[model samples]
Target: MMRRLYQSLMAASRAHAQWEIETTTNIIKNRKMLIILLLMALPLIIPAMVHAASLPEAIGGKAAYGPSYFSAKMFYGSIAIGVVAGLVTGCIGAGGGFLITPALMSLGVKGILSVGTDMFHIFAKAIMGTTLHKKMGNVNVGLAVAFLVGSGLGVTGGGIINRALYNYNPVMSDFTISMIYAVLLGFLGFFALSDYFKVRKSELSKNKIGLEKLTPMAERMQSVNLAPMIQFDEKIVPGGRKISGVFVAISGAITGLLAAILGVGGGFVTFPMFVYGLGISTYTTVGTDILQIIFTAGYGAIAQYALYGYIFYTLAMGCLLGSLLGVQIGAITTKVVSQSKIKAFYAIAILAGFINRIFALPEKLSQMGYISLTPSTGAILTNIGVWVFFGLVAIFAVWIIGTFIVNVPNLRAEYDEGSKAEYNAEYGEDNKAVVSTKRGAAQ
Candidate 1:
């Protein structure tokens, strides 16, 4: 009798599922033609929508060094760059380091000072970003907390040492840290680009040849004996799996160092590390990364930007307003481009930043007389060309934003592919509550 009842329940569920499937099919059939048109139109329309957002003149004033407020152009300039930087940072799934740091450089912002300012804005933006991600139910609290505690201490220790050095000898502290940071970032960029190419070459080989391709780095990461493991509860590809604590610590430490020195949020490295290094499913990594950033970068933002007197109200506010909207559009773009494609594009964008900095070396050396800034009649022409190269970064940034808005409709079809639907469904409307529970459990 009990077995018959169980069978009857199964049959009823099958019928209901069949009915839903039939209805879904009909709806899809009717909308197929209309959907195609919408796809072609969205990419174009999104930019126009964004352009309509005009921030207050007071909020976005010029970026300058003074006791007085900034000019309007400077304000708008910073806002524009910050918004674009935030969008790209959020888009590539990396910390926005490669984008934001260079933006300050473009403005001829002084070192350490600019680093502090950029960090302040990054912290503000990260808070905004993670807040939105949480609302969508995409955050993983346990991993974020683990990352924060370990990352925080290392950053604090580094800061203490830096301050001590600067106080003892002004010349040594300022020059040494800045140069070290620049060299380190350049090195990391090369390492990151190298690995990206390796992964791509492997993929191309798999597609072109009969050879079985393997991702050895990924395999090695999985083999490590890191302890204090925790389950994400969300399945990435399929059946849920767990990840260890130690890898999380390592990724966090790297992020903190970058955050402190360069004043970047390190979201770029952190998100990829979580997804690839610690093996957290893609579903949980964004939220986890954001959560960690909120604290880690926030610390730097406060200590460096606000506490150090680099907080430009108008510039920060303009950045906040424009970036808020830009980030939304950027989030939307994730739908149109596939994850692999986005990562590739992002790697390209980062490569561009490295190229810009690398080529700027002549300008830097000449300013210090390490190289010649003096010009023959023709040398002026070469200097002009070098200045033009600097403008490539600015032009490239404009092109990215313009293209993002212009292509929205064309990529509309791809938008929903990476949506965090499971998270939204599971947590309902209370993601923070759900995350708190997870953190407590992990601890």
Candidate 2:
């Protein structure tokens, strides 16, 4: 009996050894195959990836780096960063492009490529955010369309102004372009960080009724018989307020100026105007702003790539993947957080970005060749820290994704408030008449 037991144990031990050996062998072989595939794929993908980001003739661009598609890593980065940044900003509604464009520029992306890629991501995000808002019944479809008309007109004008500026001072064009880029970077970053902090520090309101209880103006503009009567379903103190044609034109003009000057889709400025200047609620303003930005950016991006031959397709593709996923997640998350908290977070982020811009790290780094700054008019290519920053960008993006996931509950709460405000503005005492007019006017 003892001899048989010993024999059985020996047999079992042998079987276990064989299984381990096979597992080890397979792992090694698989790893080797993966390494070989990656090595082979790098050369094929590098050209395309660089082209996509619109990298200027270096690190393998189109003209110098040769025509090609972006790398697997680049696509991964854009999707990851784009999505995370979109979610992070989408929570507040202003951070979408703010984080994206700068990061792209830092990586030596130039001209229409950077802007176009950014827009692609912005559009993707907007779709997601808008959808989520719609689900929550926060999206004001009519008001959104009306506001879009104004912003659309403005974007076209901004492009014309850019051309005029270029023609006006060819000699100073290079320097002027550089200055503009710098200003844009600093301004956006500062605005983001400052806005984040401002909201964060403000007293948290238990009541979701923001702007409802504020000092009411005696309908000065409303009494002026503005161009056409707007409609709404919500009944508010003020019924169907009229939107002045002059106000609409002025709004469009400013919207266009910001789009041109800042190189954004123009939602940032448009949302505020819809809320204050036009007496729209925060919720409706955001929904409408998203709609308008979508159209404007869409047109601008197409004009850039098709007419002017701008845009790096590879990069845009990568960014698009990330943004689509991120925006959806962010919009969904908005429902979990409180309104005050969202505002607070936005203020803090804006303030941090603002401080960073004041340092002008990009320019200083460019001067030292630690980074590259690129544009259609001026280009700086390559450096070591720039490479490091790119990696940091990826890391920060991952961090944002993780952060949003954790904050989903809080985001959901805030979204609820925004949507609720949208509903109240559309159907409540003060806004019913407004809705009636808006629907008809928008049509």
Task: Name the top TM-score candidate.
Answer: 2
lDDT tens digits by residue: candidate 1, 204-304: 21332211121344447666666776556454445555566676777787777666766655564564455444555545654565466567768876764
Off by over 4 Å in 1: 1-73, 86-97, 132-142, 158-247, 310-313, 328-352, 359-390, 397-443
lDDT, model 1, position 363: 48
Worst 10 residues of 1 by lDDT: 205-214
- Give the TM-score of each candidate: 0.55, 0.57
Cα RMSD of all models vs. native, in order, equals: 16.7, 20.8
Prediction 1 global C-alpha lDDT? 0.51
Candidate-wise lDDT, in order: 0.51, 0.49
TM-score of 2: 0.57
